[model samples]
Target: MIAIVARSENGVIGKDGGLPWRCKGDLQFFKRTTMGRKIVVGRTTFEGLPPLKGREIFVLTRKPDAGFEGATAVSNPADVPADAIVCGGAAIYDLMIPQCDQLLVTTVKKEVEGDTFFNFQWLEGFEPEETIEETDEYSVVSYRRSGPSS
Candidate 1:
C-alpha cells in the first residue's frame, strides 16, 4: 500500500480541518499519484473531501453501515486492500502507515500553525527513493520501505 500526505515544515498537515497551505503543484501531484486507485481515509477526512472521480474511496468509521454517499465504510484498516492508498487525518495515518509499502509526501517549505501533525518517526522504516516534484513552495518525495520492513 502507499500513503499520500502533505505536511508543513513543522509537520502540520492540517489547519481548521483543511490544508495549512495552498499549493497547486502539490494538489496536481496528489491527483496524478492517486488517480484510479482505492483510497482509504478516516471518517473526518472522508467527510471533508469533495467527490473524487476515478477512485474508489473507503472510509474508516465506527459506523460501517452508515453509508457514505460515494464511498464504502470500513471498520478496520485490515479491511482496506493492500494495493490501496491510505490518506489521512492523523489517526488513520497512524494506523495505516505501518502497513504501507511506499509513501508519497509533499513537504511544504514554510512552517504554519495547525492542530494536526504527522509523526516523522513513521518514515524511519522507509528510504527516500526520489524527489517526484519540487518547487519553491513544496516538494514531493517518494519513499519505499527498506530492509526487513519491506
Candidate 2:
C-alpha cells in the first residue's frame, strides 16, 4: 500500500480537526495522485473532505456497521486493496503506516500548532526516491521501503 500525507516541520498535520495550513497546490497534488486509485481513509478524514469522484473510498471505522453514502466501510486494513492509497487523520495513519510500501509526503517548512501528526520515522526503513520543491512553503518527497517487508 502507499501512504500520502502533508505535515509541518514539527510533524503537525492537523489542528482542531482540520489542516493547520491552507495549501491549494498540495490539495491539487493529492487529487491528481489519487484520482484513479483506491484509497483507505479513517472516518474522520472522509468526513472532512468531499467525495473523491473516481476513486473507491474505503472508510475505516471502529463501528462494525458504519456507513457512508458513497463509501465502502471496512473495519480492518486487510479488507483494502494491496495497493490502496492510505490517507488519513492521525489514528488511521498510525494503523496503516506499518503496512505501507511507499510514502508520498508534502512537508511544510514551518512548524504549526496541531492536534494530529504523521508518525512515520522517515529514515528507519525507507529511502527517498525523489523530491520536488513544489513551492516555497512545502516540498514533496517520495520514499520507498529500504529493507525487507515486515
Candidate 3:
C-alpha cells in the first residue's frame, strides 16, 4: 500500500485534524503516484479535501450518512483497497504502516511547529533510498518494499 502525510518533528499530525503545510508538489506527487489505485483515509481527512480528481478513495470512519457517492467507506485500513494508498493525517498512517508495502513521504526541510511527525522507521525499509530530494523545503522520497530495488 501507498500512504502519504506531512508530519512535523513532534509527531503532531493534526491540530483540529488538518495538514500542517500547503505543499502543493507533495500533494501532486501523492495524486500522481496513487492515481488509479485505491486510497484509504479517515473521516477527518475526507472532510479536509477539496474534491480530488481521477482517484478512488475509501474513507475509514464511523460517521453517519457515510458515503461519498462514488467513494467507499470502511472501518479500517484492512478494508481499504488491496494495493491502495493509505492517505494521511497521522491516525491513518499509524494504523496502516505495519501493513503497507512502502511509503511515499514528502519530508519538508523546515520543521513546522506541530503535533504530528512522520515515523522514521517507516522510511527504514530496504535501507530507505532517496528517490527525489530538491534544494527546497520539501523533499519527495520513496521507499521500496524490498529496499533500494537491489
Candidate maximizing TM-score:
1
lDDT of 3 by residue, 1-150 (tens): 666665544555565567777777767777677777778887887887777778787887765367766678787555677777878766777777667766666665555666556666665553455667554656666666673321
Backbone clash pairs in model 1 (N, Cα, C under 3 Å; residues 3+ apart or in different chains), count: 0
Error of 3 at 108 (Å): 1.4
User: Where does candidate 2 stray beyond 4 Å?
Assistant: 120-123
**Model 1: lowest-lDDT 10 consecutive positions:** 141-150
The clash numbers for all candidates, in the given order, read 0, 0, 8
lDDT of 1 at 94: 87
Question: Which ranges in model 3 have alpha carbons more than 4 Å from their true place?
Answer: 9-12, 63-65, 121-126, 145-150
Those runs of model 1 whose alpha carbons end farther than 4 Å from true positions after fitting are none
lDDT of 2 by residue, 9-28 (tens): 99998887678898777888
Q: Which pairs of residues collide in model 2?
A: none
**What order do candidates take by TM-score, descending?**
1, 2, 3
Candidate 1 vs candidate 2, TM-score winner: 1
